[model samples]
Target: MKTFLILSFFALAVSALPLEESERINGENGWYLPQEDGSFEWVDMDVAEKWMEAQEQLESRGLTTVPVKFYLYTSSNPTKGTKITTTTNSIDASNFNAANPTRFVIHGWTQSYTASMNKDICSAWLSRGDYNVIVVDWSRARSVDYATSVMAVGATGKKVAAMINFLQSNYGMSLDNLYVIGHSLGAHVAGYAGKNTNGQVHTIVGLDPALPLFSYNKPNKRLNANDAWYVESIQTNGGSLGFLKPIGKGAFYPNGGQSQPGCGWDLTGSCSHGRSTIYYAEAVSVDNFGSIKCGDYQDAVSKECGSTYSGVRMGADTNAYMVDGDFYVPVNSEAPFGMIN
Candidate 1:
C-alpha cells in the first residue's frame, strides 16, 4: 500500500511535467527527474495539469503569506531557546546583543525549529564565536504539498525581512553584521528575505537551493547573486532536488555537486541534499574545505580542475567572498569531510 501510494504520487507528479515556455523561462531544455541511484534524467511531459495545479494552489497571488516564528540561541543559552516575535519584548530580554554578529538560520520544507539542521548550524555558530543565532520557523506554511510551500516563499521572506528590520529599528542591529543561511526550500526563503530587506544583508549561504518549481523562476522568486552583498550557493544534489545551474556570486560544486561521496544510492536525494548543511556545519567549526576554481559546471563534473593550489576555501569563512568564481571541491566520504589541506 505504501509503495502503491508512492507510485501514485510520482505518477501524478510525472503527469504534471514539462512546464510551458510562457509560464517558466529557465528550464526550456527539459525537466529532470530523480533516479533511484541519486541521479537525474531528462524527461518530456505532455500535460499542463500539474503546473496549473501549482498555479491554482497559489491562486496567482503575488505573495503567498504564511505564519512564521523566530527562536534565539546564544552562547549564554545554547540548548534552550528564547522565542522572539515582533510584538514581544523577547529580543530585549534574551541574549540578543546587537553588538555581536547576528545569524539567521532558516530550515527547508517539512522542517521545524527542532530540525537537526537548525540545531547543528546554530550550535556551530555559537561554538565559533559570540553571536546571536536565530532560527526561523515557517513550519506552519510547510505542512502542505511542495508546490504550495514553494508559492509561500516570498511572503514568508517578507516576514523575515520585517523581523530583521524590527531588530534594526529597536535593537540597533546592523545589516552589516547579519548573515542568513538556508537549505533547500529554506534557501529560497533566505533569498526572499534578503531581497525584501531594507538594505542588502551582509551574506547569504544557500544550501542546495530547491530545483523543482524554482528551476525557471525569476531572480526575485529564487536565490540569486544579488540577494545579498555576498551570496554563495553550495550545490550537493544538483540536477535532482537541488538547482544545477549556479545562482550566486560564488558557487561551490563539491564532488561535482551531484551525488555526494558518502551518500551512496540515495533514492530520495535527501542524503546528498542534506549533506550541504552538514558540510556547512562542519566548515563552521572544524575545517575550511578548500576548492579549485572551475571554468564551468562541466569542468567541475569532469574533474578537469587541476588542484587546490591558490584555491578558495568553502564553508562559513566570510573571507571567501573576496573573489567571485565557481569552484570544485573534493569531499571525503566520512566525517570531517572538509578536504582542507
Candidate 2:
C-alpha cells in the first residue's frame, strides 16, 4: 500500500512540474548574445558559461522545469490582469468563449508579456473582435545566446501544442477557429506550435520573422507555408533583419519589402523592421490597407502589379488563398503606413 501511494505521489509531482525538461539543445555552442542597443556580441566560453550559470540559478527552485506564463484577456475585461502567473490549473476558462475565435499571441526575443508588440496585439484584438486572446509570456526563461532561445522556443512550441490539445479535450475548442500571431523570433515559435498541433490551426501571421541565422534554414527549423493551413508573412525590412524570401502563402512586401518611407534615412533598419508589427496592429483594427498582387517587388516599386489595377486588402481581411505568391503595397512615413495614394 505504501509503495502504491508513493507511485501516485510521484505521478502527481510529475504532473505539477512546469514545461522545462523538454527544452534540450544538442551540439549547440551557445556563443551568441543580444546587446541592449539591438546589436549582437559574440562571447568566449567563460562568458557563455557564466551566463548559463546565472540562468540556471534563476530557475533552480523548480528543479528541471522552466516557467512559461499564459495571460488570458477577453472583450469583457480587455485591459487588465496581464501579470505573469504560472497557475495554469486555476485558469478560469470562463474568461474564454468557445463561440468566439481564440488568438495566441507570442512575442519575440527579450520581450515580455506586458511589454513589446504583445500588448498592442492583445488590445487591438479585444477592441476589434469578440475574441479570446492569450498572450504567452516566457520572460522567466532568460538566455544570453540567441541560438539557445531559438532552440528553446522549439520545445516551448510543443508545450503550447499540448496546451491546445488540453483546451480541445476539456472545453471542446475548435482548431478551425484558432489562430497564432507572432513577430520576429516569435514567428518561428508560432510555426513550431502549429507543427506540433493536430494539424488544423486556421492561420499563422508572421510579422517580419527574424532573418539572421533563420533565412535559409530548413522548413522545420523556421516558419514556412506548411506550418499552418494559411500563413501570411509581412516583410517590412528585407535582406537585413527580416526574411528576404517570401515564406508564406501570401508574402506582403510593404514598399517593395525594405527601406520604409519617412524613416528619416535610417540605416540601422530599426524603424523599418519594427513597422511590420505596427502595420499588423493597424490591420487588426482596420484592414483597408490596399495590397496589390505583384509578380515581383519591381512591379510594386513601379506601381505595376499586372494589368489590372484593383488591389486586395492585406491583413485581417485578406483572402485566404492556398496558392503561394508575393504581394505589395505603397507606404508613407508614419501611422497608417499602408496607402493607396
Candidate 3:
C-alpha cells in the first residue's frame, strides 16, 4: 500500500532519461554481463581508460537510462526506521519532507547499498537528528573493473541530478538545502550531479575523489569548484587512489593527504583512501578537526599553517564563506583522528 506513483506522470517531459531500456556497455578484459549473442568479455584498466577518453555524445545517456536506485533513511539505524525507495526515473519520496535538509550519499566502485562509507555517513548524520539521507546505490552501472566505473560515472551523475531536479520542481524540494557527498569515484560522481542540477546545488563534499583516469582531465569531466556554491574536498591519498589537485574551494589536505598515521607498512594503497570516510563521519558528529589555513604543504609540514591564519573547522557544519581556502588538518591516523584546537 502505497498511494503515490512517480516517473509515470513525468515520463513525457524527461526524454533525457529513458527508463524503458537500460543497456550496459560491454567490451573485452575486466568485467561485463553476457551479451545476447552468448558472448562474455571484459576490458582491462588500459582499455577502460581508452573508453573513458573516448568522446561520448551527451554523457550518461540522459537520466533513467542507466537504472540508478535510491534508498532513503531518516534515522541512524535503518532496521529501526522505515525505508523510502526512489527509482532511477522517479521521486517516490512519500514519507520524506522536502523542506528539511537532504543529503545524498553516493558509494564508490564495486560497492552496494550497505557495503561502504555512504551508510556510515548516513548513520552519522541521522544520529545527530532527523534528516533526509538518500544512499545512491548504482550497482547496476558499476563493474569489477575500475575503467567501467569511471566510464559509467557521467551517466550516473545525470540520473542523480535529474532525480533531484524533479524533486525540486514537482515536490517543492529546496535546492539550497541539498548536499551531495561522494567518496573516491563517488566523489567525482557528486561533482557531476551538482554541476547538472537545475538551479545550482548548494554544496558538494568530495572525500578522496578518485585519481585514476580522472585527474588532470577537463573540469566538466571531474569534480571542481564550479560544481556547487560551496565545494569542500577532503583528500586522503594523493597521487594514488585519491586525487592530488585542489578541487574544492575549501580543500583540506590532511597530513599531506597520504601515508596515514596508523596503516603501518602494509600498503595496497587504499588505507588512506578509506580514511576519508572515517574522518568525514567524525566531522559530522561535529567538524572538530581544527584545520588551519596554509600556503601549501611545505608550510603546513613545517608547522607554519597554524600560525598564519585563524583556524577553521572542517565538515558539513563549516560556514562556506568563513572557511573558503586551502587548509591543512593534522590527524592521529587511528580512530578519532582529528582533535579540536
Candidate 4:
C-alpha cells in the first residue's frame, strides 16, 4: 500500500512537469519572439531610399511626408529568462513639406506588432496626401503586466516630449499641431504622452483603448488631459480589456463599440490590433468629410456614425460619447452631414 501511494504521487508530479515547463518557456519567449541580432539588419540605407521614394509618391499627390527614424531599446522578459530587444521608430515632419505640420503619433499594446510593421502600414497613409505622421515604437517586453507596460509608456512619453521639443527648436515645427493616436496599450501610452507634454499637443485619438488593466481607474498618475483646451478623442471597438468611460472630447463608436469582422480585436486576423485597413480608410474618410461644428467636434462623431466602416467592437454595453464639440474637423466642406449618432 505504501509503495502504491508513493508511485501515485510520483506520477502526478511527472504529469505536472510539462505544464510548468511550458509556462517557463512562455515567460522566456515573452509575448513575442526575442529580437535577434539580425532583426534590424534589414533596415539600411537602401531600404531607407525606397521608403523615401514612397514618401515622394505620396507628396506628388499633395500629401505631406514625415521621415521615419527607427530606434532600438532592450528589455528583459520577466517570465522567460532571456533578453529581448525592441525598436521604437519616430516619423518626423521634415519628410513632409508643411510649413508647420501637425505631428501625429501612433502607439500599440501588448504583443502589438513591431514598429517596422507599423512603418510599413503607415506608409500607405503617408502616401495618400499631406500629413505628418509619427509612430512611437517603444520597447514592449512580452507579457509584461499592465503596470510594467504603463511604466514603459511613461518613459517613452518623456522621449516623445524630447522629440517634440527637438522638432520645435531645431526643425521649426509648431507644438500646437502635435497629435497622438494610440490603440489598446498604445492608448495608455498616449495618455502618458499627453500628461508629459503638458498640453502642447492639439489632440489625442485613442482606438479601442485597452480596458480592465489600463482603464481610467488604474491610478495612472500620468493619465489626464494636460490642458483644458487640449482635445482628446477616444474610439473603442470590441471588448478591450480596460474600464472605458466617456472622457475624451468625442468618443465615437461605429457598431456600438463591438468588434467588427475585419478588425482584429486580438492579433489573429488579417489586421492587427492597432489599425485595420477598413478603420484606416474610415479614419481617412472622417478626416476628409467629417464635420467640426460642435463645441468639441461632436459633429464629427455624428458624421462617422451608422457607416459600414470596418474595425473591432468593444461589446454590447459600450456606446460612443463625446466630451467636447471641436474634437474632429471635417476635411471636405461639401461632404454630407447628420449621419453618425
Best by lDDT: 1
Q: For model 3, how does the per-residue alpha-carbon lDDT over 1-341 read when each residue is reduced to its tens digit?
A: 00111122123224334222234322212233222233333323344344444424323343223557777777544533334443423345344667668889888866776765776788788888778888888864355445445666877898789878877877788888789999887888898898788988888999988766564446888989889989999988766667666778888877877657787763545678788888999899766787778887556444467543356777847556676777778888677888687
Positional deviation of residue 235's Cα in model 1 after best superposition, in angstroms: 0.5
User: Residue 43: error of model 1 in Å?
Assistant: 9.4
Q: Which is the winner by TM-score between candidate 2 and candidate 3?
A: 3
Q: Which is the leading candidate under TM-score?
A: 1
Report residue 158 deviation for candidate 3 (angstroms). Answer: 0.4
- lDDT for every model? 0.79, 0.68, 0.69, 0.40
Arrange candidates by TM-score, descending. 1, 3, 2, 4
Ranking by lDDT: 1, 3, 2, 4
lDDT, model 1, position 204: 91
TM-score of 1: 0.85
Instruction: Report the error of model 1 at residue 148, Å.
Output: 1.4
Per-candidate total of colliding backbone pairs: 0, 0, 7, 43
* Candidate 3 global lDDT: 0.69
Report how far off residue 239 is in candidate 1 (Å): 0.1
lDDT of 4 by residue, 224-282 (tens): 55422343434433333322344454444432333333343443321323332234334
Each prediction's RMSD to truth: 5.2, 10.8, 11.0, 17.1
Candidate 4 Cα deviation (angstroms), residue 168: 1.4
**Per-model TM against the reference:** 0.85, 0.77, 0.78, 0.50
Give candidate 1 regions above 4 Å deviation: 1-65
